[model samples]
Target: MSIWWSLHLRREAASVPLARRLLLGTMETAGVDPDISFDLSVALSEACANAVEHGGDERAGVSSSAEYRVTAYLDGETCRIEVTDSGPGFPVVRGRRGALRSVHSTAEDGRGLGLIEQLADHVHYRNRPGRGAVVSFDKILKWREGALLKVS
Candidate 1:
């Protein structure tokens, strides 16, 4: 079965893990290989964290009205993932970060794009029709028994 998933959530700390867990669980049930599922989940988590950190106003003590839109699909041997945010569009340089910059580094506050660049076969960012932007990535799945890889 083809693996496809999507989630929309407010810009809240609690919602981030909840969304990721739900999507990961769905991907697992959809027969997605574990490694692919894990990578996609990591990418989505970073995207959501960026949105919440930069676009949300959590100081209000209530959930931020901001929303994140995420979609992932596997067609044929290609897997595509998209994460969109309803906040102010990110800066142009935001997508230019290279993989050499590690997100896990203690000094880096913006490493989501870098991680995406390193993990995905292809990555792009563009403004959505509204007041937001969408980041998309693609990779070719090998369809191994335990992991997704590029087909020969």
Candidate 2:
């Protein structure tokens, strides 16, 4: 069975875990392996945390209407997730590996992007300047039946 879900969440710290829990439950119900599920959960948490912390207007606090969106798609063999925020777009730098890099080792506040990259098989970042930013990643899924597949 294929599964997909999208969540429109307020830009608040409390909403991070709510998104993570929903993703985890969905994966578990789909018979996703625990290790893969755990990795995706951590990556999702980091993405959600980044959205809550950076996906907002220049104002000092999030307004009641401020929101971010998280979407997940699982088609039995692969899982893809995208997190879109309403805040100002972030800077993007290409790392030596040609992957999108958004963190500095010495910076204490921006480790989420790095963690997401390490955990997910593929990562992409798009900055919309005045519009907003999008962070997307996908991982190949393995089932207990020894069926190997790729997202197409």
Candidate 3:
């Protein structure tokens, strides 16, 4: 079975937990391995936190009601999530292989992206043309032996 859900949340601290809880509940109901679910949930929380903190485009006269979109998809043996915001898109700097961005140990911010990369099997950071930033990630899922929503 496949499941999909989306939420339009105001860019606020409280919304972070709301999104994370929904994801955890969904994964729990689907019998995802506890460790795997926990990892994904952490990654999701980081993404949501980033959006809530930097998702506002005030320079562009965007509304005070800053908002972001969180979408989750569970299909087959994988789970994917995407968080999009309406802030000014981040710059793109490519390294030899891909964007070479490093977060320092003393950094108070920017650690979330690195944490997300570590937690998820695959992670993507990009900007929506003429819109804002998008952080999308996915992980290969491991289910409990008696998973209630096992996919064929």
Candidate 4:
């Protein structure tokens, strides 16, 4: 059996807490252990936070009219999570993907995706059908002595 769940989040910082809680509850009902659930929560929170903070600027009215969608599911041994926004998709700078994994604390922004990378086993970004981008990640969950161990 597989557990699938999703939620629509408005573009705001407050939605981070709600997303974490929702995912936590979903994972619990799906029989995910507490530690694995917490790790997933952190990864999801960072993904959503990146969408809200860097995907577009609220003060600039860029994504003010848009919304974000978050989805998660467990298929066999892998836990999948996706964060999609209505704003125009983020750009991929040439030859910068590797740098993002190690560079942080720079004067400018761009570390949110890096955080997601550190936490998630496999992460990718793509454009949705209509507009905006979807960042998704999958982490392998293993049963270690009958408890869930996040084995990215």
Candidate 5:
């Protein structure tokens, strides 16, 4: 059974907790491991927070976006989450291995993204071409005994 959900939310601070609660509720109902649930929820919150804070701005005398999007998918043994915003997009940076590296600054914001890296199995950061930035991540799921996704 695959579970998926999406939210188009106003870019407000309150939206962070709202997204987190929904993800947590879904995780609980699916009997996901508490630790994993916590990690995912934290990651979701950080992504949402970034969207709320930096997802939009007054550019070229234009008004900023009032909203952003969050999506989640749970299939088989993996759970994927994405937060997309209409902000300027991620700063371009490459690591020694030629992979996109998270912001490596002392700012708290950078740490939040770095935290997401520490918690998730795989993550993708990209832009939507015409005008948006997307931060998508996934984790390997571990089910509790009575998990809805559990196979006997």
Candidate 6:
């Protein structure tokens, strides 16, 4: 069976943990491997932190009512999560391979994207310029029993 959920949260520090806990509970209830759940939970925290820090009205100094969104989808074999924010989009950077790179190890900030990329099997970022930014990632899920059996 496939499981999915979505949450619309205020852009605040407290909201980050709330999202993580919900994800954790979902995975645990679904019998997802602990290691996989931990990794995804950490990555989810990072994504939420980025949205709280960079994707909010605080940067613009106009609206105190800022919020973010988190969505998760879990099939029998794969888990996908998306975190979106209603603030200025992320800055664009290109890696040596000409791919969009949002992380800078040399810098003191913006390390979450790097960590997210390392943890997830697939990572994608979408920026709506003046509207918002979205960070989406997916990871292969494993059951404690054995390899995931394909439904079909």
The lDDT of each candidate is: 0.66, 0.84, 0.88, 0.73, 0.88, 0.86
Name the candidate that leads on TM-score: 5
Candidate 5 vs 6: which has more lDDT: 5
- For model 3, how does the per-residue alpha-carbon lDDT over 56-95 read when each residue is reduced to its tens digit? 7888675743889999999889999999999876666666
lDDT of 2 by residue, 1-152 (tens): 58889999988899999999999888777777878989999999999899888888766355532899999999857899999997876766678986556878679877888899999999988887666789999998866443333233
Q: Which segments of model 2 are wrong by more than 4 Å?
A: 59-65, 92-100, 145-152
Tens-place lDDT per residue, model 6, 33-92, is 899999999999999999998887565664633888999999878999999987767777
| Candidate 1, poorest ten consecutive residues by summed lDDT | 94-103
What are the clash counts of all predictions, listed in order?
1, 0, 0, 0, 0, 0
TM-score of each: 0.70, 0.85, 0.90, 0.76, 0.91, 0.88
lDDT of 4: 0.73
Cα lDDT, model 6, residue 71: 99
Which regions in candidate 4 have their CA more than 4 angstroms from the true location? Answer: 56-64, 96-107, 128-130, 144-152
Give the lDDT of residue 56 in candidate 2. 84
| lDDT (Cα, 0-100) at 119 in candidate 4 | 74
- Residue 38, candidate 3: C-alpha displacement in angstroms: 0.7
Model 3, backbone clash pairs (residues 3+ apart or across chains), number:
0
Please identify which of the two predictions, 2 or 3, would achieve the higher lDDT against the true structure.
3
Arrange candidates by lDDT, highest first: which order? Answer: 3, 5, 6, 2, 4, 1
